[model samples]
Target: MTSIKIDRSACQGYGNCVLALASVFDVDGEGLVVLRRDTVEPGELDGLRRAAYDCPTDSITFVA
Candidate 1:
């Protein structure tokens, strides 16, 4: 499984992560990005990486 981490302090609530990986990331009512799953399936890793790369703040980290 792949693990994902997000630095809340660095996050800008831009929703880019959510848009890129809706199954793994979600935007709360306040527009903050939230991790829906800690462990990602192998098939989802590509989307997760895309989301992490899309983050303008570069707050997302992946641990494989």
Candidate 2:
């Protein structure tokens, strides 16, 4: 199983991750990243990785 993590302190609210994978990520009212889930589905891994890379603050990370 893969696990997704977001460093809230490091998040810049850029919304790149949310754009990349809205099902897995979203922006709260304050515009910070809100993780929809921690465990990544097998099919979502690629998109999740892309989201992680797209984050300007490098707040997204994963354990596979």
Best by TM-score: 2
All candidates: TM-score: 0.91, 0.95
Poorest 10 consecutive residues of model 1 by lDDT?
A: 27-36
Tens digits of per-residue lDDT for model 2 on 1-57? Answer: 799889999998999998899999999998999988888888999999999989989
Give the clash total for candidate 2: 0
TM-score of 2: 0.95
> Per-residue lDDT of 1-64 in model 1, one digit per residue for the tens?
9988888888889999988889989877877778888879999988888999899999899998
Residue 52 shift from truth in candidate 1, angstroms: 0.6
Candidate 2, overall lDDT? 0.92
Candidate 1 error regions (>4 Å): none
Residue-level lDDT for 62 in candidate 1: 92
**Cα displacement (Å) at residue 25, model 1:** 0.4
